[model samples]
Target: MFRISPFIFILIFLTACTLPFNQPILTEGATVPRPQNAATAPVEEQTEPPTAIPDTQTQPTDIQNDTTNGATTDNLEELANTTPADRDQVALVEALTGNDLPEFARTEPLDVQVGDTETFWVSDILNDSNYEVDARLRYAGPHVLMYFETAVDDQIRQEDIDRAAQEFEERIYPRNRALFGEELSPGVDGDTRLTILNITLQGAGGYFSSADSVVQEVNRFSNEREMFVVGLNSFPVGESSYGSVLAHEFQHMIHWHEQRRGPAWFNEGLSTLAEDLNDFGDDNTTILHIQNPDIQLTTWSNNAAQTGQHYGTSQLFMRYVYEQYAQDGGLAQLIQDDAGNNLAAFATMAQQTRPDINSFADIVADWAVANLVNNPSIDDGRYAYSLLPETTTPVDLELNTINDINQFGADYLTLPTGTTTLTFDGSDTVSLTGATPNSGQYAWWSNRGDDSVSTLTRSFDLRDLTQATLQFSLWHEIEYNWDYGYVAVSTDSGETWTTLEGQTTTKEDPQGNNAGTYGLTGISGKPGIETDQGEVGQWIEEQMDLTPFVGQEIQVRFWLIQDDAYNANGMLIDDVRIPELDYVDDFEEADESWEGQGFVRTTGTLPQQWTLRLVKEVGSETIVESVETNEAGQANISVNDGETGVLVVVASTPYTTQTATYTIQSETR
Candidate 1:
């Protein structure tokens, strides 16, 4: 159900490209803010080799002066004496490249140091070997650093980086801390620094890499490090767009440090959620998945065709959890719990928040249904939150009564008048002579003490026809005195109605005989009314003439009414036909009175001959009927009476084959 619209995707993609500062931002060296009672433990240092060191041409000895040694008491006093801006700039540089560098950066001596006039440089840190200075920035705030590539400094101005840093420090960092209950700071190993480098990361708009992975090639990059690096796509994405990616990757960094990264779905979902929390707006791709419930959420592969759906569904599922189950810091608790598995972590969180939920599968099933109906009040608000856009609506009935009754096994339709509850008895519990004609696979039984009006109407212009005949097969056992079914018509939709005369009702006697009685017999006087004198095992075919209303735009309706108690086997109507117009029948619900008849319409500029074949399954019998459509594109075909069997109408053309099936009951009367 994930409906993917390329236009919407492109629109969102362009919006992300235009709004750079909307990305989530993290301040360097932010720490998880813990409760007063909860002591903040220091992150244990890991003595592992660097994951991948930058391929730099020069040695990292150019700026190797110890930061603590350089800032003497007199020098500190001088620094304090300077302007506020200069003091803040010096403080930030010290925080980023001081004696305690990120754990990964500490593996090798880093040529990172503050220069005169408050400027700092990390030599060849961006892995851009072509440039001697990989990243250079001027400190803009106590926790913010502004970087602009020297190669594109003319195009990428200092103001852009400063704006990005301001947004990150002001908007993104505090928001994340509020939701995550932690500050974005270095991990326990202290091998890396929280730094945002504006450079082209290979193959992605932005990416987060642990310091350990960046420093040297390690067997695996463990997230249990003090600091990580954020690489933003450095193509002048503006501050908002830049902040969006930062928010996304920052969640990754946080998840790495606070909780062991689970699956790609969880990591991506949380990161995307981070973007939303920072007010970057919901990821449009995720909206697609939220609208479509049929998409599988768990299995995700990078190269799979459904990669976008995977990302979207993951984000939506997490959003649902965050909104429905974990509004009160449960998300943060789950992440910190680090249950070691995604399902286990989710289950634990659900148990603490939604104790009623038994398992993750329950949540999924409820969530899937919610994605369709979205009514929170349903089922005690279990699947209540509406994360998807307002564009989503409830699912329509798969098969409407007018289209295919066999699929529904009953005459079910949304009536214009009001609601009607018609229950079908498909178990063959009530029968005649051991044959369940009235109780075939499908038969609607009226409810006792129920007085309601159920009508099925079809509208069409009959101006072109000289004569119109209404014919149908019926099996009924309504309360003789109070309940009845009638055939009616209207020219003004359902505003007014006129009943057709000569209608009759039939019911099977206790001895399996068709007992016919006049009820509201239509014009033709119930021509084929079976009179076996028992429970009408043999179905009766009736006809009504609509010749008077032939030249007008008219609507025909079948009304079945029941009142008071003592309801019997109600009715089974099938193979209803208005020749030259349409035919509707449910093979599973038909009785012996059903006739193999239907209409086939073909459209072409020229008249075309077509074949209509009626195949009976009992004897493997095939009856082929041929007809030609007029210039107006209409063909009506009627097959004569056939032996009891499954009857199928195959309308064939050179290019198409359309088939409809019905069941003809054995005539026992």
Candidate 2:
């Protein structure tokens, strides 16, 4: 006796379709005599021959004695009892009434011979076998044959079949054909039929079974080979999900026949594309690709860890390429091209669509850039879509108070005893003199406490300056035995310092001898060192030449130091100055001789540090050429070539800014 094992049960659920007879559904957990060739038999052996039963035949009352030709109903009870209870009753009804069976099943069974093979009725084998009938339904237009272990009427209705057929014909088929530019063929037996079996599909919505010869058969009606069989989950799934799965599997079938096979990424990517193309929109599973762009396209693995990203990125890449370069029938061309393999197919498509892009590497690079900088206004045709607007410009720095010290990138520190502050002392103010009014705020009293120190440090660029100077007003009260003050400068941005000569001082004691480490190395001076002890005395003007630091960037620091013994009122500093040279150029005079001279002057009373640059404006971009000034703040810039150009002379320092533009013509002296 022929027997269907559990594995075959699953295989049948994947590929079996309705013919013109009632197929005997194998029992769920029944032991029967296994066929001699059960292990080695081909798929055809598992499928019984077609059956024929007349419509006039009523439901049989006596099951045991009912026999027709070599077929007997003796095992009906055994078949019913062995199958699942829900399916057992339905199988018994099909066996008895033959009402819901196909029209072809109503005819007498025929032994049609084709190529020396005899075709027997499927019912003939059922009568002699111990299997039972489950549920079955026939759907025509997308030619679906649905089977389930539950009753057919209970599990699926004709309307469900109609909906499936309508979706496949109206949406899935047209979209897939349009994408691939190829006609879908029937299976090996000349039938474009889809056997949609209801089974427990683990971790999937549905699957296409390619191993079945029936699926691979040639369709006699369309005269094309069948694609494959579809297996759907037995549980209820919404029409949208069903439609998406149908389209997805159909794309797989189309791809299978088009190129035999390709890389998993391409295969899955195209199928996902088909799903969205069918108007199902992208499901949650595929959107992950865009969310995670780090995954490489070609190296996407289909395992559990990467399944979502792999599918998503693949679809994204394919869609990106399609929208950007292959709006024409390039994707279809890619599908049909016989490039031997997936990479070769891609290469061929890339070559035909974008000859400039050499390989997938270049495509990936451009794709990554598009994902990152998706600004269309500045895109220059690189990105396909714009994602964000332009970024905001940074605010310019302003000089206001000592708190605005940040403008010059300077820092003030009062260690162990005092805090740096900007305040006016009653007797002294820098603004009353030559200092800018905003610069009148003096560096007030430092720590009078023992072992205290105070510092004011700032850095400036003097690369283009011919001359510079540091000058300030100071008042101090220091005990001759313990405290002093000084000024220092560093060329290497304050990593080290060199104190200027004649800048340090200390008050004298009653004996008229300076006892502290005053006027030592690395010390500038104590300004009011001659004042009486404990007196915040007269302010003194001080100057330090900065010409040595010209043409170099440097930092200057002010220091107030106190010894471990007695400390008097500390120090006060105002009108601290690092003069930057300002440029005054006579372009008209220079143009007459192809030479321009500019004078740099101190913005205040002291010489300053400044940079001079000649900028040529070409379209929207400005190119800077450095110009050096002489000790007299004179910059003689020559434009030798005889061409009209827009030139800008810009001079800037940590303390001042000036700009001059000239529209000069080429003229000989």
Give stretches of model 1 more than 4 Å off.
1-133, 144-146, 181-193, 211-237, 339-342, 391-669
lDDT of 1 at 326: 74
TM-scores of all predicted structures = 0.40, 0.37
- RMSD in angstroms, all models? 36.7, 41.3
Q: Candidate 2: where are CA atoms >4 Å away?
A: 1-135, 142-153, 181-184, 213-238, 299-302, 338-344, 351-353, 376-382, 385-669
Clashes found in each candidate (C-alpha, N, C closer than 3 A) = 59, 37
**Candidate 2 global TM-score:** 0.37
| Model 1: how far residue 191 lies from native, Å | 7.1
